[model samples]
Target: MRLAIIGGLAAGPAAAAEAKRRAPDAEVVLFEQGPHISVGTCEIPYLLGGHLEPETTLQVLTPEAMERTRGVTVHVRHRVTALDPRRSRLTVEALDYGSTREEAFDRFILATGARARRLGVEGEDAAGVFTVRDLVDTHAIQRWLDTQPVRHVVIVGGGYIGLEMAEAMRSRGLRASILDPNGRVLGSTVACEASDLMDRAVAEAGVPVRAERATEILAEDDGRVRAVRTDRGELIGCQMVIVSVGVEPRTELAAAAGLRLGDMGGVAVDDQMHTSARSVWACGDVVQIPRAPDGRRVLWPLATMARRTARVAARNAAGSASTRSADRFRPFAGAVGVRAFGVEVGSVGLSLSRALDAGFDAVATDVRHVSRTRAFPEAAPIDVRLVSERGSGRILGGQLVGREGAALRANVLVPLVIGGGTVRDLAEDFDLIYNPPLGPAVDPLKVAASQAMRDAG
Candidate 1:
């Protein structure tokens, strides 16, 4: 049972490790184009903030470690240029030196991850402009900081990566500014109120956010990027720029292999993470699955998703008798914790507008209260909005904004969502722990539910 995994990052390595564990004698090989595998994308900003050492986060697993510990052949600096699913083979190009070869596998797992999206704007290729998506990007930008007189930085995009990078650069004593084309910061992921709160938090950190602004990078006379031109005709000079627009799935290999591609531009996979082609599977950012809220297929890229996908894909790849099931994989439960920036904002399930768009007669209730016991020292005001079906009172979605610890409180809604608990169920439910210092007399969940009950009437 020979298995070849195209990527050695998050999902690929997980699948390889799992497959080896499932079938101890199985021949498993993991190929990575870069020097490292299993690197943490979330910690890139922390590395920039000097919170972590470069080696601590960059190389997740060395080839020597993977080979010796996992008994798996790990190939670094190798590219799988082409795949021949019909022939059960793949063409590999060794990047270390001049070498081309073909690898045959009884089973194949395509875990190729997504890359950072580039705007392709003028001066984008300049030395000062960078994207913080991978370890190399982090190293490159950090190296530039050593050589360049980086006093000011302009961050393009207001998404998760953008916000994290903004904080990282600012904490390092660089004057950071974010230019977002959206009307509000993090508008694509968070709702209006949460976005505004985050914006305020960023402002408090001395980071200015330019909203609804498009940027055009202008090169200086010395062929270096000097300033970014905006739609408002403002040319802001900055010594460095970090562009973190978003990510797109790398599905060219999947598409060429005649596998179905989803509307979200990811490879289509079944519940088991198996592709349309037999003996082949796909996972990670390159595979789009169904979102629970709307039953629509979309790419919800996250480390959690990568890990789960790896387990499912590996089971099928190893031909395990106890195959994995879809129930093991749940729609992503994600939130953007704004508490790190001073305030707390948490969102889950879906939004009111999205619920309505999905054909639900939804009504939402907004409540304000303290996040902790009233007598607690640092009890901050908590503002929450919960959306429920107008008549049925089915819990659809929720958002929380408040002081620290508010994000963790919002996580209580996850089980309710997964269990299909409604406003009525929450109103009558009695299932939670309470400590005076950690919570109020009445849990915020019940308080919000009771408030929603009133609004439902």
Candidate 2:
């Protein structure tokens, strides 16, 4: 059996290794358009902030190492220009030599990941504008900082990356400001109270956020960025601009090959991670996952979903012939959108707005509780908002924001929400321990869940 994989980032490489494990004798190959593969994309910000050295662990595995250890062929700087699902073949371009070649496969997997979104405004191609999504992007931002006198940086989005880059720039003694048209960070995915907590968090970090649209990028005579022009006809001065708005799935190859795509703009995959096309599947940020509580397909560009879906796609493709597990139809497990920040914030399943959009009569119950008891010195507060369905009393989702346990609380919410647990289930059935200077007598998660049960009643 011949297996061909497009993309060499987190998902693609993982699928290749998993395939090799499942079918040892099968010929497995992975292609990455960039010079590097198996990158630790989440570490890019620390590299920018000088917290990490690029020469260190930023790149997880090299092409040579992957080929040597995983028993799979790895190709870097190879671009898949076209894919023909009917023939089970693809056209690959050697970027270095500018030569094209055809490869045939019995099974194929696409982990094309995502691309940085552009503002579509003029002067975007100037010298000092950047998007720090990959190793190459981090290196480019480093090069800009080294070559140019960048004392002031304007981040164009207030999402996770934008907020991280803001702290990263400030840590480097650069004045960083956020320009978000949505007037808030994290968008509408977070509950209203959580958004308020995020606002306070960024302000305390000394990052000024401007709630306005950036209409254009102004550059100097030498084609270097100078300022950003807003829709209100105001110019926000800056020497550099980071475009961290967000990312969309890179599904051009799949779409051109007549593969189905979900309304969420990701390649539509079934429970087995199989695309509509025969003998082909897609994972990573390119594919959609079934959101819990309502099974609505959502394109969440999260590493956890990418890896889980990759395993399903790989095991199904490589071990399809085996009747070892009759119902080997594996779907992605539960997933929640989580971001690490000074004031960490995360949401699982659905927000109140998303519940309403999904045609559920839902209400969000907010609770503020202490991280520790009063006896503990300077116990911090945790903000949790639980979203519950009205009549059914099902636990739809939750948003948590705090400096201490926001991310951990989010992890606790995932299993319960995915298990179809109800408000009462979260409130009483869940085991939450308590200790002074560790956690309060009644955990914030339970407090919020109990509040949600009351609101439902």
Candidate 3:
């Protein structure tokens, strides 16, 4: 089998490695436009915090290492400019030499991740202005920091990435502040209470919050950032600026090749990660995923989705395309949005608003529980909120917020949410762990679930 994988960060390399393992004799080639493949993107903020070295995180696996250990050929500094799915061929550009080549494959996977969203405001392209989406962005920020006299950093958005950069800035003894367009800067995926908790956490870190949008970035004469003017007519002065507004899928190459895109603006793919084109499957941030049960499209641009979908796509691509079997087609298990931010938050499935948008008779119930039993002096409070269908009591979604156990609680909800477990099942069916240092006798998740059941009744 001759398999080609386009992209590298998380999905591309994952599919390539899996394809090589699934078909040992397969000619697997992975192409990455960036200099590094399998880069540690989540650690970019920490790299700014001076907690990690660039080489340690920037390059998770070198092209040489991918060829040596994984038995796969890697092409870094190369971009896939065009794809001819009809011919099962792709046009690749050697970035270093400005040369082009044609590559033929039996099957291909598009793991082309996401790109940083721009503010669309003036002076956004100035020096010392950046977005922390990839290793290249981080390196650019580092280079600017080495030359610029930075004391304060103004973050344009108050999302998870903004919160992380706030911590990173404070760690480096630099002042940081966030400017969000609304009070619920954390976005709708987080419950109102969870947003409040995160707000408090960011405030505690000495980062100021402003409910405004950046209208213009005021830069110095040398094209370096100096200040940002908001729509509110207020100017936020800072030596550096990091725009953490969010990201959109990089699917132009896929779309130009006649691949279908979902309403969610990502490349559309079936359960087997097959795109509309023959012999071409898509995965990673480039594809829109349907949330479990409700089947509503949710933006799951996280690493988990990339890895999971890539494995499925690779397994399918490894088999003979002509002898396709239904039994051999591995279905993509839906995602329960899992993320760890500055406050250790994990929200699975859907939020209450999302449930209503999905046309569910939903009710959200929340409770305050301790991280540990009362006997433990170090026990901290954990906020648990669960959303369930009002009529059938099916678990819809959940959000956990606290200094500890939030991500752990989210893990427990992952299975329940994915398996379509009900509120009653969470309340009465299984026995959860009971170590005083770990959790309460009845887990906080169950406590919230029980409340949800009662509220549904």
Which candidate number maximizes lDDT?
A: 2
Candidate 1 wrongly placed segments (more than 4 Å)? 53-55, 192-195, 320-328, 335-339
Per-residue error for 402 in candidate 2, Å, reads 1.2
Q: What lDDT does each candidate get? A: 0.79, 0.83, 0.82
| Candidate 2 vs candidate 3, TM-score winner | 2
- Measured with C-alpha atoms, the lDDT of residue 81 in candidate 3 is 97
Candidate 1 structure quality by residue, lDDT tens digits, 1-457: 8999889678888999888987899999998898887787788888888878755756677779888998999988999888888899999999999699998999899999898888877678776899877878878888988888889999888877788888888778889988887744666765544335566788899988887454578777776678888888898998888888888888888888898898778998887888899879998889987665556667877777888888888877886645555324566544445444666677877778877888888888887777678888888777778888887787877888765666777787776665667887886875656677787877777888998987876
Candidate 2, residue 199: the lDDT equals 83
lDDT of 3 by residue, 68-118 (tens): 999999999999999898998999999999999998888889999999899
Cα-based lDDT at residue 94, candidate 2 = 99
**TM-score against native, each model:** 0.94, 0.95, 0.94
Which 10-residue window of candidate 2 scores lowest in summed lDDT?
324-333
lDDT of 2 by residue, 120-167 (tens): 999999989999789888888989898988989999998777877887
Model 2 alpha-carbon drift over 4 Å, by segment: 189-192, 322-341
C-alpha positional error of residue 117 in candidate 3 after TM-score superposition, expressed in Å: 0.6
User: For model 3, where is the 10-residue window of minimal lDDT?
Assistant: 327-336
